[model samples]
Target: MNGTWLTVLMAVPLVGAAVLAVLPRRIDGNLAKQVALGVSLVTLVLGAVLAFSFEPGGGYQFTVEVDWISAFGAHFALGLDGIGLALVLMTVILAPVVILASWNDADPVDAAVAPGRSPRWSTHSFFAWVLALEGLAIGVFAATDVFLFYVLFEATLIPIYFLIGGFGGPERAKAALKFLIYSLAGGLIMLASVVGLYVVSADSSFGPTYLLSELQQVDIATDVGRWLFLGFFIAFAIKAPMFPVHTWLPDAAAQGTPGTSVLLVSILDKIGTFGMIRFCLTLFPEASEWATPVVVVLALISIVYGALMAIGQDNIPRLIAFTSVSHFGFIVLGIFVMNSYGGSGATLYMFNHGLSTAALFLVTGYLIKRRGSAQISDFGGVEKVAPILAGILLFAGLSSLGLPGLSPFVSEFLVIVGSWQYAIWVAVIAVTGIIWAALYILLMYQRTMTGPTRPEVAGMSDLKVREIVALAPVLVLILGLGLFPKPLLDVINPAVEDTLVFVDGASVEPVATAVDDATAEEGDN
Candidate 1:
C-alpha cells in the first residue's frame, strides 16, 4: 500500500465514476446517489489510510513511477509530498460533502434551477462528473512528472466543464463556456512552456526528461528560464483568477450549483497556487524571486479588488466567489513572499480556505434552494425563522472574515506575519483586505440573516438533518483546526523548509515581531 497508495487513492474514484457511467440510465437516482456517496466515502477512507501511512517529515512518500511517453520522456509518475498531501486530504474530504450537499441538486423537478431553465443531465451524470473531477484533482496533486501533471491538469477541465454547463442556474452553459475558454487559453499558453522544457531537457546531458526531479537539475540560462516561467505563471494566474484575468469566476459561481462551486473554488482553484509553489518557484527559483515585486503587487490588487467586489454583490453565490478571489490573493501573496511563515501559511491556507469556502457555499446554497433565489434582496431575518440555518451561516461567515478561533485566522495571520517580514507596506495593504472581508461577510450576513423577516422567507425551513450532517464536519474542522493547527503545521513546516532551499540555500525561519525578541531577551536576563 505504501508504494501503490497514490495509485490506489487516485484509481478508486475514477473507477467509481466509470462504473456509474456504465450503469443503466433507468436506474434510480437515489441508488445512483448512494453509489456515488458510498464510492466517495470509500475514497475518503483510502485518503485517510494514505494520510496515516504518510511519514510527515519525509519527502515524497507513496511514490509510483512507470514510463508512459518515452519520446517526450514523460512517465505515469505519482508522489505525495506534504504539500500534495494537504491538498489531497482537502480534495477527498470535500468530495463526499459536495456529493451529500448536492443530493437533490440535479433532480430535474425536485432541484431548483434558474428560472426558465432545467437540469441538462441526470443526477448520476452530475455525480459521475464530480467523481471524475475528484480523481483527476488527486492526480493533479500527486503527479511528479511535469507532463503527467499537465495532462491531469488539463483533463480536470472536462468533468468540471460538464458540471458547470449541465447543472445549476440558467446561464450555466455560458458560464461553463467562459470557464473552459479561460482555462484552455491558460493551458495552451503553458503548453508552449512545456514544449520549451522538453527542448531544454533534450539539449541537456539528461537527454529529454519531463520528471520534475530531473528538470530541477538541468539549469537553463536566466533569460530562457524567465520566459518559461512566465508561460506557467500566466496559466496559474488565470486558474487562480488573479486580478484582470479573474472575470470568469463570479459568473461561474453564481451560475453553478453550490456543490459545483465548492469543487471549483475550494478543490480545483488550489491547483493554481499548488502549481505556483510546485512548478513556478521550485523549477524557476531565480525567476520567481525576480518576479516577486510584480507578483506581490498583483496579489495585493486581487485582495483589494476581490473584497470590494464581494462587498457589492447582490447575488449570494457570486459574492462567495469574489470572496475566494480575495482569499486566493492572500494565498498567492504568501507564496511569493518566499519565507517559511509565508510558504507554510500559504500551503495551510489552501486547506483552511477550502474548509471555509466550502462551508460558505454550501450553507448559502441551502439558503438559495429554500428561498428559490440567490439574490440578497430575497432573504431577510432568516434567523427569525430558521435559527439553526442562520447560526451555521454566521459561523461560516465569521470563518470567512478570519474571525479568531476559526481555522482561517491562523493561516491568515501567518501570511500577514510572513508578508510583514517581506515588506511592511505589503503586509499593511494586505491587512486592509481583511477589513474588506469583514464588511462583505458581515454585511451579507446582516442583510440576509438578521433583518426583519421578509414575508416570503417567514416560513423558511431550517437545515434538514442531512444538511446538518453535511455541514457538521466543516464547522467542526473550522473551529477544531483553528484552536489546534500544530499537527498540520508540523507536517507542512518541513516541506516549506525543503521548498525554500531552492530559493534560499538555508531554511528561512518565520520572522518574529520585535516585541517577541525583546521579551525573549528580558526572560533570558
Candidate 2:
C-alpha cells in the first residue's frame, strides 16, 4: 500500500506476469495474446490514473514512501516529477503496442526450438516478462530512493538480456551474452561508486546513504566526485550504448524478434540517458561540470561514427541499430550540457525517440515476417501495397530526421539551443550530427520503401487490422507530441530546472538562472 499510486502503475505489470504464470498451459495463442493484452490495458489504465493525478504544478504528487530497509535508509520511495511522469507514461504506451504488433507473428526462436511448444506459453512468457520489465522500468524512473532506484535500474537488464538471447534470431546467444557482459560490467562498476558515495559520507556521523537526495548533500572533494561520477556515467553510457561500448546493441537488435528489439532499444536503452539525468546530475554536479568536455567529445564521435556505420548496412535491422548509436550520442550531448534546456530536451527526446524508433522497428518487423528476411534489398514499393504501414514509416522516419513539427525536432532544438550558452563550439560540432540524421534516415527510406517491388515483396499483404491497431498509438503520439508538446514540456521543465540548480554554487548564479529561465520559456511552448 505504498500510497505512491505510481507504484500501482508499476506493479500491475508484475501482477499480470504472475497471473500469466498460472494460466492454463493449454490456452490458445489468441487467448494468450488476449490475456497479455488485458494486462497491458490494465497497466495502461492504472498508468493513466497515476498520470491524471499528476499536478503539473503540484510537485511530486502520488508519492509513496515507506521503510524498506532501515539500516540502508532506503525507503520504498517512488514519485513523479514531470520528466519522470513522461518516461513512465511513454513506457506504458510502448508495451501494448509492441505486444499487439507481434501478436499473430510467430515467435521466431520459439518456433525453431520447440515446434511442439504451445504458442500460448511462448506468448504468455513473453508478455509476462515484458510486464515484469515494464514494472521494473517504471520503478527505475519513479523510485526516489537511490538504493531502490539502483535495484530497479539493475533489475531491468536481466529480463531484456534474456528476451534477446532466449528468443531472438541466429546469433541470439552471442548477442544476449554480449549485452549481459557489458551491462553487468557497467552496473558492477556503478555499484562501487554507489558504495563509495556512502562510505564517503560516513564521517558525517550519519555515515553514507544511497538515497540520492541524501548523497547530494554529502559533498565530496572535487577530484573524488569526478572519479565517482565516471563510474555512474560509464555505466549509463554503456546503457546509452554510446560509442565503442555501443557495439552490443546492433547485434542484439538484429538478432532479437521485433518485439524484443522494441523493448530493448526503445524503453530499456533509455535507462542509460535517464540515469545520466537523475543520478549523475543530481549526485555529482561538480563532476558533471568537469566531465562536460570529455562527454561532448565522445558524443560527437558516436554521432559521426554511428551515422557513418549506418550508411553501410545492408541489414535493415542493423542499420536501425547504427542510427540508435548516433541518436543516443545526441541524448548524451543534451545531458552534459548542464542546462535546463539541454536536460529537459534530452528527457523529452527519450520519449520521442522511443515511440518513433519502436514504430520503425515494429513496421520493419512486419515486413521481415512477410518477406522472411530483414534485408533492405528485400523491400521496395512497400507503400503501394501497404500505404498505412508505409505512411507510419514515413512519419516516423521524418521525425527521426528531426523534421519540423515532429517530436525529435523540438527536443533537439532545445538541446542545441540550451547548450549554446555554455558550450558554443561543442554545440557547433554536434550540429553536424543533426545534418547526418537527415541524410541517413532519408537514404534508408528511399532505399527500402520506394523503387519497384522485389520479387519477394510484390505479393505481400498489407497490414492486418491488429497490426494497424498496433501502429496507431505510436503514430498518434509522434504527431501528438510534435504538434502539442506544451503540456509535456510544462511538466518536464520544472523538474529539469530543479536538476540544473546546483548546491551552494551561487557565484555562478546569474548564468545558470538565465539558462534556467530560458528553458522555462522554451518549455512553455
Candidate 3:
C-alpha cells in the first residue's frame, strides 16, 4: 500500500472523472458536483495521510518507478520531496473548495447562467474537468522522470483550456484560445529540450535514461546545456507567465469564472517556479547560474510592473490577476537568489499564495454573482449588507499584501532576507513591491467594499452556509500557518538546502560578519 500510494493518489480523481463522463445523461448537476466533491475530499485525505507519514528532511518519500518506454529509457516514475509535498497538499485542499464554490457556476437552469455567458457543457463537464486537472497536476508535481514530467505538464493544459473556454464571461472563447496558443507554443519549445536530453543521455556510457536521478549524472558540454536550459526555461516562464509572457494571465483570469481563475493562478502557475528548481537548477546548475542575472532583473521588472498594472485595473478579477504577477516575481526572485532562505521561502510562498488567492477569488466571485458585475466602481459599501463576504475579502486582501501576521508575510520576509544575503541592492529593490502591494490591495478594497452603500448592492445577501463551508478551511489554514509555520518550514528547509547544495548556491557568510572579521584582523596586526 505504501509503495502504491503515489500512483493511487494520482489515479483517484482521474477515475472519478471517467465515472462522471460515462454516467447517464439524465443525471442532475447536483449529483455530479457531489461526486466531484467526494473524489476531491478523498484525495485530500490521501494527501494528509501522506503528510503525516512523511519523515521531515527525508528525500523523495512514497516513490514509484516502472518502465514505460524501454527502448528510449523512459519510466513512469514518481516521487515526493518536501517541495512537491507542499504543492500536492495545496492542490488537493483547493480542489474541493473550488468544486463547492463552483457548485452553481454551471447550473442547468438557464436563469442561473450569467448574462452573455454560454456554457459549452453542463455542471458534469465542469466538475469533471476540475477533477481531471487535479489528477494531472498531481502527476506533474510527483514525476521524477523528465519525460513523464513533460507529458503530464502538457496534459494539464487540456482541462484548463476547457475550464476557461467552456464556461466563462463573453470573452471566454477568445481568452481560452489565447491561453492555448501560448501554452502550446511553450510546450513545443520544451519538446525540443526533451529530445535533446534524450540525445545527450544516449551519449552517456550507461546509455539513455529519462529518469531525473540518472540524467543528473550525465554531463554535456556547457553550450549544449545552456540551449537545452533555454528550451525548458522558456516553457516554464510562459507557464509562470512572467514579464512579457505574462499578458495571457490577466485576460484569462478576467474571462474565466473565479473557480477557474483560482486553479489557473494559484495551482497551475506554480509549475513554472517548480520547474526552475526541479529541472533548471538541479539538472543544469551552470546554466541556471549563468542565467541568474537576467532572471533577477526580469523578476524585478515583473514585481514593479505587475504591481503598477494591478493598481490601474478597475476590473476586480484582473486586479487580482496582476497582483499575482507581482507576487510571482517575489517567488522567482527567491528561486534565483541561490540560497536556502530564498528557495525555502519561494516554496512556502507557493502554498501560502494559493490559500490567500483562492479565498480572494471565491469571495469576490460571490460578490460578482450577486451584483452581476465585476467592476470595482459598480460595488460600494458591500460590508453594509454582506459583512461576512466583505470581511473575508478584506482578510484575503491583507494576506495578499503580506500583512505581518498572515502566511504571505512570512514567505515574503524569507525571500527578502535570502535576497539580502545574495545581493543587498536586489533585496532593497524587492522591498518596494511590498509597498506597491499595499496600494493595490487597499485601493481595491476601499473602492469596492468600503464606500457608502450603492443601490446595486443594497439588497445583496450575506454568505450562504455552503459558501462559508467552502472557505472555512482556507481561512483557518491561512491563520494557522501564519502563526505556526514551523511544520512546513521543517519539511521545506531540507529540500531547499539540498537543492542549494546541488546548485552550489548555498548561503554564505554575511558581508557584515566578513567585514567585522577583517577589521579585527587589522587591529591584531
State the lDDT of candidate 3 residue by residue for 1-525, as single tens digits: 364998999999999999998887698778998999999999999999999998877788898899999998999999999999999999999999999999988864454555557687878899999999999999999999999999999999999999999888889999999999999999999999999999999999769889998888898789999999999999999999799899999999999999999999989999998999999998998999999999999999999999999999999999999999999999999999988778888999999999999999999999998998999989999898998998999999999999988999999998998899889999999999999999999998899888799998999999999999999999999999999888898888778777776675456343234446889999999
Looking at model 1, which ten-residue stretch has the lowest summed lDDT?
A: 506-515
Give lDDT per model, in order. Answer: 0.92, 0.80, 0.91
For candidate 1, the per-residue lDDT at 444 reads: 93
Task: Give per-residue CA lDDT, model 2, range 1-525, as digits (tens).
Answer: 235467678888888878876777677657767878888888888888877777775666677877787766667888788878898999999999987887754443455643422233266677777778988998998888888888888899878876776567767788889989999999999998877776687766556466666676786888888889999999999998898899889999998878888998899999899888888887888888777888888988998899889888989889888989988988888877776677777888898999889988998888777777788866788777777777777887888878888888888887787668556887798788778878777887887788886777778887888888889899888888898887788788777777777622312222235657889999999
Top candidate (TM-score): 1
Question: Which prediction has more favorable lDDT, 2 or 3?
Answer: 3
Higher-lDDT candidate of 1 and 3: 1
Global lDDT of model 1 = 0.92
Error of 1 at 514 (Å): 13
Residue 493 CA error for candidate 2 (Å)? 0.4
Superposed by TM-score, candidate 2 places the C-alpha of residue 222 at a distance from the truth, in angstroms, of 2.3
From the highest lDDT down, the ranking of the candidates is 1, 3, 2
| Runs off by more than 4 Å, candidate 1 | 110-114, 505-507, 510-525
Instruction: Report, for all candidates in order, the number of backbone clashes.
Output: 0, 2, 0
